[model samples]
Target: MTLPAIIDALQCGTFDREVLKMLRDGGYRCVTPTLGFWEGTLESLDSLARWRDMERENAELIRIVRRADDIRACIADGKLGILLGYQNTNLLEDRIRYVELFADLGVRVLQLTYNNQNELGGSCYEKEDSGLTRFGREVVEEMARCGILADCSHTGDRTALDTIEHSPGPIAITHANPASIFPHARNRSDRVIKALAERGGVIGCAAYRNITPDWACATARGFADLIARTVDIAGVDHVGVGTDFSYKGDDAFRAWMRMGRWSRQLNYGAGSASAPGAVSKPDWLPSADRLSDLVPALGEVGFSEPEIAKIMGGNWLRLYEEVFG
Candidate 1:
């Protein structure tokens, strides 16, 4: 089997009305944001300067989805629902107040830290991780109050644990894998992985091609293997697909990824051979992309039909409903 059309959900950049139409035309019901955002994007929402020019260039196809029911409804009606999220909190600045503001604007999930240390907490890319500070606690509290999911995918070890322990609402990790199987700072440990599952959260294991040791299970198969292993450790109900798809202009994207808040600052962001690099271009859309290949990949790993549904999008939908409905 090739794959299904329902996927090709969200991309890192370049969503326009024409893009949305093509996605809808392809029979896509919903498009999940494996990684919901970039720093320039959130800042651009308020200012039209650089982002404005970009938006105008890609006009008509961009949307920010913030609710689970919205996605279900859109998928049912043959439209695409964009799940609003972010890869880092640098866009939030220091004011935790922005969490609710973004929530009001339809941003549902937020990663505590991005590539480097922000005011809230230390990032995986940072040389030292001191965990969540008082300010970071306030940040998590605000996230709970606003009903936005607290994400730990890019957070440091201690910070992630602290957030998990303190978050009032169920937490969400958009993308990760087992560091034991493949050593990577972006990956999680068994203890933390199980903790997330026990805490009623979902861990989205990505394609992470760079992190995989086995060449045979590279694409969807590799993605599924990590998800399956995570499910085995955390249970089926705690897994989902967080592709970490960073689709955009290659040179520009790499520049952004390698830089800190300012340009020309090279940072060692987290990852290993098991993980995939960022997305490729601004014009790409995952909705029209073939994503269902993971279903068979799941089958190869002995995942039953029901488990497949959960890993694909069921668990994410359930959690999304719990917090964002």
Candidate 2:
């Protein structure tokens, strides 16, 4: 018998009917789409509304997933469940109450910062990492109270650690890799990984090329090897996949992601200055359709069938139930 549908814990891309179809064809039952990459209240509201409209428009093929049980039901019924998420807390606009507001809006995951300093905390790319501020602590508390999962993907090291320590519940580094594997600024250290696992949190190993050694060698098997190593370090129960896949490869999409509305000049944050607008995806796992390749790759790397199942989706499912429910 086939395994249950997989859940991609973190995905940063445009969500539409085509994307849903691709996920369905790829055997995904649930995906948490990050519609609020750098969006504030109005922008996040608009994006969330658009997705809600899409859910309504394609009710037969997809539905909004608010609870953990919805995931298995969607898979059993042959539909894709969209779990709304935000990559930054810009939508809160400094008010702690907005955490509950956005939580009610179907945002299950909320990243504290996105590549730069925000009102709440510092980012990994900053010249001096300032860590989480007083307000940031309040936001974490409110998120726990409101049943929203705290994420620290692009947050500064100090801030990420602060959030993990300050949070009343487990927090996630939703889309980052181990810095030990490939020393990128965006990757987390073993210290952080251990702290996260100790707190009952999960880390989703990212598939972005910049986080790895080189795009040419970052094939599906190579990525799976990285995951295997991560599992060895963080334990299989504390690791999952967060592909960070972007459907749009155009310069416009690149500009929006890199610069957002923060600057007019190109900011080569993750990508290179020479190819600032180009998205370098591995051929072996180019899109959501190729995610299934990880199963066999994980097996080849010595992950048992049960372990592979947990790494693929079961781990994330448990995290969602604990945090979102």
Best by TM-score: 2
lDDT of 2 by residue, 1-325 (tens): 2564677878866667788898977878888888876777898899988998998898888988988899878868988888888888889888888889888888888899987899989998998888889999999999998889999989888898999999999999888898988887899999889889999899998877777656423677888888878987899899998888777557777677778998978698777766555656877876778889878878888888888888888888888888877
lDDT minimum window of 10 residues, candidate 1: 279-288
lDDT of 1 by residue, 1-325 (tens): 4223243322454554565566566545455543423464456355324333433554444334567766676666656556666667766767777777777766667788776777888887678998998989998989888878888988888888888898787787777777887787777788777888778998876554444445323455655676677787989998876655553346555556656446464443443334234532112124334455567878998888777777777787888788767
**What TM-score should be assigned to candidate 2?**
0.96
The Cα error of candidate 1 at residue 317, in Å, is 0.7
Superposition TM-score, candidate 1 onto the true structure: 0.81
The per-model lDDT (C-alpha) reads 0.65, 0.84
Question: lDDT for model 1, on a 0 to 1 scale?
Answer: 0.65
**Alpha carbon lDDT at 177, candidate 1:** 73
Off by over 4 Å in 2: 215-218
Who wins the lDDT comparison? 2
Over the full model, what C-alpha lDDT does candidate 2 score relative to the true structure? 0.84
Q: lDDT (0-100) at residue 30 of candidate 1?
A: 55
- Which residue pairs collide, candidate 2? none
